[model samples]
Target: MTSTTAPKPRLSIWMRIGAVLLGLFAALLLLLALFPWDALREPLNRYVSERTGRKFEITRRLDVDLGWRSAAVKLDGVEFANPSWAREPYLVRAERAAFDIRLWPLLSGRVVIPHLALTSPTLGLQMEEDGRRTWALGKNTSDEGTVPVIGLMEVDQGTLDFLAEHLGVDLHAGFSYDSSRGEMPLDFRIKGRYQRQPLMAQGRTGNVLQLNAAGQPPFPLEIDAAAGHTRLKAKGTVAELASLDGIDARFDLKGQNLGDLYGLLGIALPQTSPYALSGELRKRARLWEAAGLKGKLGLSDIGGDMKFDQSQKIPSLSGTLRSRVMDMDDLGPLIGLPPTERSAKAIEGVAPPPSITEVKRARRDSGRKVLPDATLDFERLRAMNADVKYTAERIRNVRELPLDKGSVQIKLKDGVLTLDPLNLGVASGTLAGAIRIDGAQNPAEIRAALEVRGMQLSRLIPKIETMRTSFGKLDGRINLSGHGNSVAGWLGNASGDVAALTGRGQFSNLLLEFMGLDGGEIIKFLLRGDRNVVLRCAAMAFDVDKGTMNSRSVVLDTEDTVFNVSGQASLSKETLDFVVRPQPKDKSILSLRTPLIIGGTFAAPQAGLEAGSLATRGAAALALGALNPLLALAATVETGPGVDADCQEVLAQAKRPASREAAAGAAKAKKQ
Candidate 1:
C-alpha cells in the first residue's frame, strides 16, 4: 500500500485528457436530453434534407422527449418536397408525425426507430412508362453498420394517390393503421379509375412490418371489390410492397356478365351470362398464375389454367380454357348489350315480366348500345401480349343456328390481335374462319374471312317449310374488311363479298306451288298437307358497300319452275328488299302468279306481286325472304328474262364452279 502510494506516479497527462473528454461526452448527452429542442429545429430539418435529398420542413410545432428507454421526437405540419418531375407539390405531407428512437443506438450515431406514427398524412406516387416508380426514394450506397429497425408503424386517416399515365391508371385511396395487436393491422379504401374504367375496393392487411423485416416471409391481406355488377373477393399472403414478388391467394368471383371481368382483369373476352368462379392464385418472382380454375361462363361449365408473366418490359399471358355446351347469346354483353333486358316493370311499374319475344323486339327496335365508348381501349390491349386457346364441346340452344362444337385460337402481340382458324361444327358440316384486329389504328382495323361447307339445308333452316326437309349440301364464303369498335359499327363501315350455293336438293311442294305459274298446283298444295318437290339448284352472290349488301344474281331451279331474284339487304337499318320473277317449266293456261316483290325488316317481311306481273291484280303471298340461299345464285343464273329451265338442265348446271358440291370440295381440299 505504501509503495502504491506513489500514486502510480500521478495520472499520465494523456490519460487525464481522455478522462476529461469522456466526462464532456456524458455531459453533452445530458444537455441533449434537457436542452430546448425547438432551438434546433432548423438545423435538424436541414440535416434531414441533406441526408434524404429532399426538402424537409416543420411548419407549426415540434416536441422532443428523452427518457432513454422511451424517447420520442414529434413534429407538426411537416412536408417533404416532391421529385423534380412529380406533379404533386409535395412527396409527402403530414399533420403530425412522431418517431420513437432507441437512445442506445443514437449514442453510436445510429438511428433505431422502434415505432413511427403519422396522423393525417398524404402521399403521392407515380410510375412512368419506362417502369420507373416515384416511391423508389433514393439511390442506395454501401455503408457498414447495423441498419435501423422500425418495429411498429401507425397511420391515422392517411391518403395515397398514384398515377400511371401509360397504363391509363389514376387512383387515389384512404388508409388507416393500428399496431395494438402483435401484428400491425391496416385498413384501406380506394375509389377512382384503372385502365380507364371505374374502380373501387376495400381491404385489410396484417403484419405489414414484415415487408421490411429481415427473414420474414409475407404479409396477410383480405380485399373485396365491385366493378360494375361484378364482385370479387380475395384473401392471401403477399411480399414486396413495390412489386408483387411473392404472393399466394384464394379468390372467388360472382357476376351477371363475365365480360365485366375484361375491365377488372385487363383481358379481352366476349360477354357471357351470369357466372361464379373460384380459384387459387400465386406469384413468384415476376410470374403470376391462377390454377385449378373452375367456373361457369354463361350457361356453360368451365375450368382451366392461366399464367401471366410480368418480368418482361411488356406483360404476357398464356392460358387454355374449355367448356361444355355454351349459348351464343352469352356473348351479348361483349357487344355492349345490357346484362338484363329492360322491362316496362322496371320503368313504368308494369307488373308482368315482358315475354322473350317482346324483349327481343324492344331491343331490336331500339338498337344496341353499340360500344358505349367507341374508342379503342389501347392501353388494355397493349398492356400484355397473349397466346390463348378456347374450345367448347358444344354450342347450342339458339334458333336456326345449331353449332355442335367449336374452337378459337387467340393470339396477340403488341396491339394487334388475331383469331386464326375459328372453326365450328354444324349439322354434318363445318364453319371455318379468321379475324384480324389492329388496335394501333385510330379507329381500329378489322378483317374477317369465313367459309361454310356441307351444311344440311333442313338442319340449317328447320323452321322454313320451303325447304320441306330438303336434303342438300350448302356452301359459301365471306371476305370482309372494316374499321370500328363493334360488329355493328364495323358493318356500318364495311366492304366485302358474300356468296352461297346449294346442291341438288328437294323442296316442299307448298313452296314451289306458292310461287308457281300453275294455278291448279297452288290449289292442290292448299289441299295437301305437305309434299316434296325436286330442287335442281339455288345460288346467290353479293357485294357489301356501306352496310348494304347488293345482289349480283339470285336463282332457284325446281322441277316445275326457274326463279330469278334480285335484292339488297341493309345491315345498318336491318331491312330486306328484293324482287322475284318466276318462269314456268311447262306452259299452263291456269297461271295466276308472277314477278313477286319482297320488302321488310328481318323482324317482319312482306311479299306481294309487283305491278307489272300478269297477276298483279291479285293479292301476293306473305313469305319470300326465307329463300336466302338465292343470294349466291347471282353469279351462276344464266336464264334470260322469260326463259324456263328443264330440271335436267338445272341439275347439269349445278356441276359448275359455284355449285354447292364444288364449293364443298374446294373447302375440303383447302383443309387437307
Candidate 2:
C-alpha cells in the first residue's frame, strides 16, 4: 500500500463481488426476455424421453413468462408414450396445459407450483401383480425429497383410466375442479369393475391444491358408491387427501351378504343374511377402524368395534362384537347353510337377492338334507388372518334346543380356523366346546369336542307340562373328527363318541308308559290323569365308525319300568334302525308288551311294534286264553329282570381321550 502511494483507493472484495453478480443478473434477464422457449421444446422432449425411456413430444407452441422469483410455462399440446407392456399407447395426453412454478425451490431440488391448469387432459395408469406401476415416472432414485407443493389448481374435462391386475380393478374416472366453489373444489366419478364385480362411485372433495399444504386442514369429502349388491355412503374428513393418510368419517353399508365383501375389500367373513350397518370409520397409514358399529343383520341387532391392520405380510382383522338380541335363524350361514329366506325377506320386505335365490334353487335340486352342504372358501380363509370375540346376550328362534346367551373366541391363521371356548347357555345350563378346521388340506379336516352340564330336563321339555314340576337334569358329551369341507360330509365320515345320562330324578308317569308301551299304566294314567314318577337313572352311549353310529349302551330305569334300546344309525345314508324293549317291575292287566321298532330315513322316521314279536305275543296270549281266561294275562306279564345303569360309570366314560386332546389344543392355541 505504501509503495502504491496515491495510485488508487483499494476496491473492497465485497463491492467487486456485488458488481459481478449484478452484471450476471442483467445478462440472465436479457437472455430470458429474448429467448424462444418454443425452439428448445424438441430438446426438452428428447431429454425427458431419454430419462424415462418413453416417447415425449410437444405438438404445438411452448412458451414461458419470466419473473423475478417464478416462471409461467404454457404448452399447446403434449403427449407421453406409455411402456411397451401397457395396454394403452400413451401415458398422458393433453390439448393444453399451463403452470406457474417458483424458481428458487428448483435449486433446492423441490417442485413448488403456485398455480396449475389443464384442459382436455387424459391420463392412463397401469399396475401389475409383480409390483409394476405405470404412474411412477422413471426410477425411484431416492426417497429424499418432500412431496411437491401446489397452491391452486384447476381442471376441465379431465379423465383417467387405471388398471390394477393384482387387485382385479379396472376403472375409468373423470375429474373436474372449480375454484369458485370454495367448500368443494373437486368432483370425481368412477365406474369400473373390482374383483370382477360392477363398481360405480361419485364423490366431492376439498380443494386439491391444498393436498400438500404446510398447515394441513381437514379435507372434507362425501361419497356414494356401489359394488355389486353392496352399497356404501360416506361423509368425512381426512388429514391428507393425497395419500389418504388419516381419515375420520361416518358411513352406512348395506349388502346382500357379509361374505360378499371378501371380493370388494379382501376381508374374510362368514356368510350372513342381508345386512345394514352404520358407524364411524377411521384410518391411519396401514390401519383402519370401524367404531361405534351398530346395525341390523336380518332380525338381529349387532354392535362392535373392529380394526383392520394391513401392516403385516397378510392383512389381519380384530374385534369384539356384541348382539343384544340375536335371532338363531339369522346365523344359518355360519355352518355353510344358504341364506335363510325368512331373514333375507324380513330385512327389507322384498324378494331375496339373485344370489340367495340361486342358492335356494341349488338346494332344492340337491333334495332334502338335514346338514349344511355349502362349501367354505378356503382361498379366502388363507388370504387373511383374524382374531375376534363375539357375545350374544339373548337368542331366539331355536326350534329344538332352548338356547340362551352365547359367546365364542374365533381365531384364524394360515388357513386354520378355531372356535375355542364356544360356550352357549342351554336350558339354564351351558354347552361348552372347541372346534378346529384346517382348510390348508385339500378336503379339509375338522375336530370338535363339546360337553353339556346341568341342563334341566324341565326347561328342556317345557312343552311337557308334567316335567315342569320334575327335578331332572341332563348331561352329555360329544367328541368327533373327520375330513370334509361341509357339515354333512364331516358327519357322514366322522369318527366319534357320544354319551348322555341323567341321575335320580322325577319324571312323568304318562310319558314313561308311552315310551315303554305299558298298556296297563297307559290306561291307568288316562283314567286318573298324569302324575310324577321316580326316575332311577338313564344312560345312552354310542360309538361312531365310518359314519355309522352303533348303540353301545342305552337304558332307562324307573320305579315301575325299565326300557332298553339297541340298534345302529347310518349317518351316510341318514337312516335309523333301532329296537326298544320294555319290562315292567310289577304285573298288570291288559299289558300286551312287544318290542318297538324304529326304522326309516331321518327325514321320515317310522315307529311301530315289531311284527314278528307282536305275532308271537298274540299267539301266546291266544294259547293261554284257550287254556284259561285268567292265564292269558300271564302271557304279557313282565319278570322285572332289567338292571339299572351306574350313573358314575356312564359319566366317566364320556371324557374320551379325543376330548382331552381337543381341549389341550385349544389351550395351546389360546396361549399362542
TM accuracy, model 2? 0.86
The C-alpha lDDT values of all candidates are: 0.69, 0.79
After superposing candidate 2 on the true structure, give the runs of residues whose Cα lies further than 4 Å from its correct spot: 1-7, 46-55, 65-72, 83-89, 99-117, 130-133, 136-154, 176-182, 207-215, 239-243, 349-367, 466-471, 619-672
Candidates in order, TM-scores: namely 0.69, 0.86
> For model 1, what is the error of residue 50's alpha carbon versus the real structure, in angstroms, after optimal superposition?
9.1
Name the lDDT of candidate 2: 0.79
- Put down candidate 1 lDDT per residue, 1-672, tens digits, no spaces: 355444565458779999999999899888987898888789988886787567889878778987748688899889977666767767679998898888877677576676677788898877677655554534221132433556555676788899888876788889877766335377889987876767799988763434343355677878898765667799988765535556799999776655456667755555555677889999988888989899776556778898988788988889998887676655455455443432212222112234334555676444333323234566667778999898998887756687788999888888888888699888668989987878878677777778889988788877764445566888887766777876767766566666777868778766676776456666666787668877777777666765677776567877777787888888777687998878766544446545788987765778877776543333222122134544422322223334545534443333233434323333332331
> How does model 1 fare in lDDT?
0.69
> Could you list the CA RMSD of all candidates, in the order they appear?
9.5, 4.6
Off by over 4 Å in 1: 1-42, 45-200, 207-215, 255-275, 335-383, 465-468, 482-486, 492-496, 543-553, 570-575, 586-590, 601-604, 615-672
